[model samples]
Each structure stands twice: as structure tokens, then as C-alpha cells.
Target: MFTQFVQQFGVTTCGTMVWGWHGRTLSSGVHHPQYGDCWLRLLAAPKAKAGGKLWDGPRLAAERFDGRVHKAQMYASVPHVLDDFAYLAELSRAITEPVCSEEPVLREEPALPDRWWASLQTDLDTVAHGTSDRVAVRQEWINRVVPQFLNVEPPQIRHWAVAHGDLHPANLTAGTPYLLDWEGFGLAPVGYDQALLTAYSCLVPGFVKKVRDIFPVLQNEDGRAALLVVIADLLQSASRGDHPELAPALHELARTAI
Candidate 1:
């Protein structure tokens, strides 16, 4: 059944004959003696297309097969981020809790409501010292704006469903747009996805307005400030890599942070 579908949708991928190992969302190139190996991540369509072709959609980390560490982290983290946001959005609507408010939508989670903002602070602290100083600065900015603009007092965030800790286009894929990578996913901060998306909008135009319309709570400065925090976080993330394609945007985000 899978092979038939691949025949139809999978793009013709060319590389030296190498071993293939499949995982949840990625396939690794078997280490080979010659013609350095590469990875081919298959993105099968939800439904098969013409001629029962299986679309071997895109290959992630094609050039370098050595850094299994970074590749695995990204693969897991990206989907986890998407799932968290999607889950939180659904829970917020089901309970009719203002998606934009920093309050718990699921009152049943009592312990959660009490420590929402505190949890955020802890995460911020982790990033400040662990990720980069810029991340810490951005988190500080977010803390200031929350009380002043969003009117969120001592407990600015409400207990809610888990959130996709980090969300951005690079971490996501349209074929499997909603994969689950749980490492950074957690609960805290309202409109977190919108903030991340808005920050990404600076790189891809029209993204900001589109995300804002879908997430109405992001219309003001408070929401935008929250978005800046995520953007700063992403900048720190991008800086850790040597991918030239990511450097320019990271540099731009750094400038925007100031």
C-alpha cells in the first residue's frame, strides 16, 4: 500500500545508493563507505494522488549527515511546537476562555492557574542563561509589557493546555504541518503562537496580518511585544547554526530586537 502511494506522489529523489532508516517524520540515510550519505525525509500526502505516486516530498539535512544531534532536535521540536499551539487553541475555544487573556481556560486544572506566570518566568530564566543574553532581554521586555499593556497582574498567564514552546515556518512543514515534538512544548503565555508567527512575518510579508486576523488578541502592543520575545528566541536559535540561509534573517531580527 505504501509503495504504491509512493510511486504516485513521491518525487524522484536522486542520490548515491545508501541505506534508509525511517522514523516518525524523517528518514535517515544509511551511513555508507562512498559518496557521503544524505537524509531524505518523506512527506506523504494525506491522500494519494495520480498514478498512485508517493510524493517523497522534501529532503531535510541533505548536505550534512554528520550532525544527527541538531537534526534530531529540530525534527522533534518543530512538530511538537505545532501540536502544542493547535491543542491550546482548541482548548481555549472549547472553554470559551478569551484566547488572548492570561488566565486558565480549564478551571479543573487548579494547580496550573496558580503557577502560570511563574512557569513563564522559569522558562524565561532558562533561556536567559541557557539560550542567549538577547533572549533574556526580550523576556524582560515581555514581562514589563504584560502588566502595563495587557493588564495582566501578578498572574499574567492562566493555566491552559500545553503550548508549542517554539513555532516558526522552518520548524514546520505543510505536508505534515501538525507533527508532535514535545521537547519545548508546554503551557504558559497567551497568544504565544501568534507572537511567534508575527515575528516570523518580518521575514515573510503578509504573515503578520494573516495571523492577527486569525488570532484577534494580537492587535495591540502587548501582543506584539510578546511576539518579539519569540522572535528574539528564534534569533538566538538561528545564531547557533552555521546555515548561511538563516544568518541574514537572524541578523535582521537581532537589529529589530534593539
Candidate 2:
């Protein structure tokens, strides 16, 4: 797939391959003859479930949100099949800054200036205002997972808004707070993005406190509900053997929050 696209798109893969969770995605830094440096993510899934809003997320996001808060998307490709599997690719301007943390789930808080925090708040507010019909988090899914994973009475969701959908440490950049991986952005419970970050930062008490302090919504009923929902979702993921190390922390956080 890499060789085929490099030749077809006239791009040279300059960086080592970075595989995403479960090998679902393969990303590499590429240099294009005309476009210069770029980042390419090749997404793969079973052919039966290969294409959807996620396939075009970066392209669509580029149309609505500018590069100030996210990487500027350059191009997207139609599905390319390989027997029972299908593949698609998205290209965006390479972000020169390092990720906010070395990993997706923060093992420890990274050094971030107050100005960066302020910019993150501003950018997240902007993200919530983004319009999209996609449903990133569904009430039905929340209803089912919250009780199952959180073991608490699910809090009612009174508000809904667009969110970055995925805002973990890896998806965020350090210096100025650019959100990556727009594939999950859409309408979710209010403060979904904020709560998601908080859940992921559960192991870091200082970072969790700071995030809760910065986002007042975390103190409200709706935002609290959002936090539980995100916790439930992550716990579900952990149950499936994805980051099981987070299971204990997430469960502890859910207990305290509830």
C-alpha cells in the first residue's frame, strides 16, 4: 500500500512507519514533489466496514476548521481495496511540533505553559461550535455502557454540542494546542471533549485537577455526565484489551466522580 501510493501520488516516505492502534492505521512523513513535506495516514479496515464519515473526516474538517487549531488537510483518497480489506489515505501539512505527551494516554503531565492552556480552551470552544451531522457519541451507547462499566446510575444528558471527539495527549500538539485525528469529531454530550481529556488524565492528579479547574463544565450535571460517559467508553475499550493498564485508573476515577 505504501509503495503503491508513493509512486501514484509522487510522494517519498521520509519517516519511519508509525502504526496506529491495532494496526488500523499506518502513518508516515512524506515529501511530495510539489506539496513538499506532508503527513500521510493510511486507514485500513475490513472491506465490509471500510468507508464512512471517518473516511472523509480530515477533508471535511479542513473545509470547516482551519489549520490554526488543527493540521491543514491537503488531500483524501477514495477507497483502495486489497482482497477482504480496504484502505484509504489522508494527507495533511506536517506538524513540526511534538505531541503534547509521548503517548495517547498521558503517563505523566507534560510541560505546558499557561498560554498553551488558554489557547487549548479557546480552540476547544471553537471546536464545540463546529457544525457536523455526524454522531460521535450516542445517548443509546452511553445508556448501555455507563451502567455496565461505571456501575452508577447514568446521569441524564441535558445538553449536546459538537466536540473534537478524540482529544487525548497524542492527538494534541504541545506549543500551541493543535488537535489531530478529526476522524471522531461530531455532536456529543456537552463538554465531551473536556471530560474525555480528564478521563484520560485520571492517573495524573495534578493534570486532572487543572483540567477540571479550567473547564467549569466539569462541575455541572451535564459535564459530569459527559465524564462518566467517556469513562464508560474507555473502560469498554480497556475491557477489550486495549490499554488495560488504564482500567484500574479509569475505574478509580469513575468511583470517585460518581
CA lDDT, candidate 2, residue 110: 84
lDDT of 2 by residue, 41-81 (tens): 88888999976777767666777786546555566465589
In angstroms, the error of model 2 at 72 is 3.9
Highest-TM-score candidate: 2
**Which runs of model 2 end up more than 4 angstroms from their true locations?**
82-84
Q: Give the per-residue lDDT digits (tens) of candidate 1, residues 1-258.
A: 223222333323333332222322333232222322323333322232311111211112111211221122222101112221210000000011122212111111112232333443343333222221111123445465434422333223332223344444444322212222222444435556556645654544444445566565556544544554555455554556423344355346434333
For candidate 2, give the lDDT: 0.83
Candidate 2 total steric clashes: 0
**How many Å off is the CA of 64 in candidate 1?**
34
